[model samples]
Target: MKVLVKLIFLLTMTTPAFAQADFKTEQLKFDRVSAAYEEKWNSLQEALRSAGIGRPFKLYMAAYKAEGKLELWLKTNGQKTHQLFRTYNFCAQSGILGPKVKEGDLQTPEGYYYLNVFNPKSSFHLSLGISYPNQVDRFRSGKEKPGGEIYIHGNCVTVGCIPLTDDKIREVYVLAVEAKNAGQDQIPVHIFPFKMTAGNLNTYLKQFPAHRAFWTNLQTGYAYFEKNHMIPVLSEKSGRYLFK
Candidate 1:
């Protein structure tokens, strides 16, 4: 009876570690993910070390549709600001510059989101799901069905999604897996129509006048991060985004 009790105590003490292990273990069960780790993990780890970021660091991602660029930012655990780590080009483009309004709009959404799913068996090699149609999107759509199933994926083909090509996604997927295994439950992903620099905004506003109001709202968040390199706390109010 004493030995049994001692064994149970040891298992209980290791529960959290086991929980973290389950995520990676299950992910590695997929062939593509295992291959990604085999191909990219060593180089990625070296890059992380050079950046002064270690395992369990936080990740923040941002994408610019017009520029066809995706940027990965990282910060060590307990750090407040994220530093730019790398940039990947979007291998394909979809709809014009604007927020996705309804199902089949073919417009990749623009707004605050997060990685909500990780699919190691993705048809496009591997993919990280984006949580779109959040409260703000629903509020804006009103009666329309805001489209769903957006992702940062591979394959270099898109109807209304960001595609980074198979080779690039392998690197990104590995980094995301490491971050998730480190206990990042909600990895932030912010998508914008374009880099919201004043010059770019002014130029685009003239060509796409209808999106002026919405883009202006997005600029506030962009400017905040541009100045601080920190994610801004945002709230949705009656179909509009308010940054705090």
Candidate 2:
């Protein structure tokens, strides 16, 4: 009886320790990423300063699907307008040029979105979730089956998400995390079909007349940002985007 009681005691004692160890391991996974950010912080700060961006600034991102490019824009504290900072090329393309419509459509969404979550332990190495199925997406694609979980992630491969090379995503993710930690909420990510220049629009019309009206609506927001370096307030009406 004494031996059995001792065995039970041992098992009970060891179980909590095992659980604690597992928890620590999980925590360290995130900690490692934090350490990486800290290590690279100075270099990022230097880049920002060189570009006239100050610390703890607001950030905006624009992705051009046709060009395979992602542009980063920044507005320093006390500044009225954002300035272009850097552009990263998407490493892969998926689906086609249009808003994602269904669960299995394999289409990368085109519209306004924001960073919603950060994942350090992403299977794609690291990732930032985009708020897909936004008001416009749900209105256009229907509420019940609009699909979701779009992300800008590392790994250079994608089904319906933006893929950056692992190195590039690490830089982007680190900068975004720093922006979040510094109190910049709602970092905007505007995904465009292309640059939306008149030339580009003409090309789009010739190739994809079916999508011209929708792309035209997107151009209003695109033009506002290009001319003003500020994001316009967005609203939805009847499944279409209206920019103010």
lDDT of candidates 1 onward, in order: 0.92, 0.84
For candidate 1, which ten residues in a row score worst on lDDT? 49-58
Could you tell me every candidate's TM-score relative to the true structure? 0.94, 0.85
lDDT of 2 at 77: 70
* Segments in model 1 whose C-alpha atoms lie over 4 Å from true places: 1-14
For candidate 1, what is the TM-score?
A: 0.94
lDDT of 1 by residue, 1-244 (tens): 9999999999999999889868888898999999999999999989988888866888999999999999999988999999999999999998999899999989999999999999998888899999998988898788999989999999989989999999999999998888888888889999999999999999998889998878999899999999999999998888788998
10 residues in a row with least lDDT, candidate 2: 19-28
> Which residue pairs show collisions in model 2?
none
Please state the error at residue 157 of candidate 2 in Å.
1.2
Query: What TM-score would candidate 2 get against the native?
Result: 0.85
Give the Cα RMSD of candidate 1.
1.7
The residue-by-residue lDDT of candidate 2 on 95-199, one tens digit each, is 988888878788899998999978888888888899998777887786458788899998988889999977788778877776665567689999999999989
